[model samples]
Target: MSAAGSSTESARRVAVITGASSGIGAAAAYALAQAGWDVVLGARRLERLQEVAEATGGRAIALDVTDQASVDNFASQIERADLLVNNAGGAKGLERFLDTDMEHWEWMYNTNVLGTVRMTKALLPKLRASGDGLIINIGSKAGLDPYENGSGYNAAKFGLKALTRVLRIEEIADGHPVRVTEIDPGRVATDFSLVRFDGDQKRADAVYADKLNLSAADIAEAIRWVASLPPHMNIDTMNIMPRDQA
Candidate 1:
């Protein structure tokens, strides 16, 4: 990756992506690496993160987004970053509010809500230093419309959308060139449901059994496009889903 604010014309840009061990985060890391951006990956699973980093020829760091010290240290290690992809989050289960475990609710709140904020806060300095920074928050369609038994997950995403909107405005007002973008995608065939169900393969597979689903590559491409835009251009928001999905 190029040094921060260097004058070399052909210097490669740097991108930092969280949750880069698998799913959309991994796909985006590979895509960015291939696009000539030096990438730094962060995730809880060190082995998986190492695998993706080696495959993409990028750097990897073990990160637990819920932990403040970890996030702070990771931010300090990044000297320059033109893009920050906040993609670390997941649901717990499909259960009514009254039936859900309080621990599940706490877990969702910690990772999905506070985790994003911690990353953004920690990275803002480096992002601002780059002079052409982009922040992409991976939201979900559930944020737009809450479904039965999806109260906790939906609430976190909805808060994320609001957070992005506010950050966009604040950054602009502060004369920072940082751009915030949100990509709210519908259901995709990923380890998302599997983790939510605590490794119930049968139940996870059932979510996409009869329908065409989005791949991690799909969302990765969208993120790449948003990050590749001209300095004067910004893709503020995008929502993508499979054709069969409504």
Candidate 2:
């Protein structure tokens, strides 16, 4: 490639997305790529991640967000990151606060809350250097409205909401160019239920069956839209829910 061509390619905005192996993450990767943003995908499942990368013409790197070493390695591979989508999180189980197992809570907190912290910490420098950086944290409506039998997941998402807000405030106070936004979705039809139910396909299917539910692609569109907006604009939080869902 000529120097100009290389420069143009380098100038194209690049986005990094976690949990890109499947669900909303994968859809977001495709949507961003379709919108002319170069995307880098990361997930623990390398094969699935590679498939999405291939389909979207993006790069895939194996990443386990819950692990600090993995997060470090993932960050080191990226040369530039104008957008970072922290989507690598899920619920383990649904139980009442009284019946909740500490193990589930630990997993939820580590993956949903600490995982975002690790990724944001690792990539903040690159984002700041980009001059126009954006970080989109995938949160859940459960964070705002707690429900029965969802203590662990609710707490984790609530924590994420708090973290996202604080990060935005800090960036403003520090006069950094980086922008922070949280996309809090109510219910998207994805493998989230399967993971939460521990591979119980029936239960997972039942969650969305005969009910109006959002799709991963729906959330991906929101992500793409948010990233495509002018740098001067910052959407602090967006809550997406199906029309039928109150």
Candidate 3:
């Protein structure tokens, strides 16, 4: 962390990134830090978050979006937040809806939908305090178009889509300056598949095998661009896919 009253730290904006321990969240931290934003990284994994924070010159705070207390504690550490990247979300299983374990559904919804809610609500005050706050909710292509055996993840992302839209409407209704954007990407190569398959490396590896896929950095760049835009500009929603994803 930079010394208090340091001009460099004071001049730069602060961005809080959830799920910053890995994948898109970690990538976003580096990208934002590089672009002169003081990033606050949050995740359940302390070691990974710490490493990312050190690498990006940011701060690491243990945050579990699924836990309200953790979210509150995480928010308490952030005195100022110009941007909140709700990136701490993922899929859990590939079984069809009927055959899928309920536990899979619960975890997916909790992490992807409710988790975003917890963080957004916790950080909204500061984001509003920024005078030109921005919230970027990381979404998935599954949210846009569901696929076979993706019932749980699809449901979570779709719910996230609705949540993002409603929040945008509410803020607009209240006439707040907060900006909301949802970026949905397709075929990003990350640990996402591995986690979804319960660490089955072969199954996870096959998802992107012999196919074009986006990197975590690619989605992170989109987030950076959206955040860097003028306050009056709103991306609304953006869907980025690999050239060959279709």
Q: Per-model C-alpha lDDT, please?
A: 0.90, 0.93, 0.92
RMSDs, each prediction? 2.6, 3.1, 3.2
Model 3, C-alpha of 241: deviation from truth (Å): 0.4
lDDT of 2 at 124: 99
Error of 2 at 135 (Å): 0.3
TM-score of each: 0.95, 0.96, 0.96
Between candidates 1 and 2, which one is better according to lDDT?
Answer: 2
lDDT of 1 by residue, 28-73 (tens): 9988877778899999999999999999999999899999999988
Q: Give the higher-TM-score candidate: 1 or 2.
A: 2
Clashes of 3: 0
Residue 193 deviation, candidate 3, in Å? Answer: 0.6
Question: After superposing candidate 2, which stretches have Cα over 4 Å from the reference?
Answer: 1-7
Residue 31's lDDT in candidate 3: 90
lDDT of 2 by residue, 58-166 (tens): 9999999999999999999999999999999999888888888999999999999999999999999999998889999999999999999998999999999999999
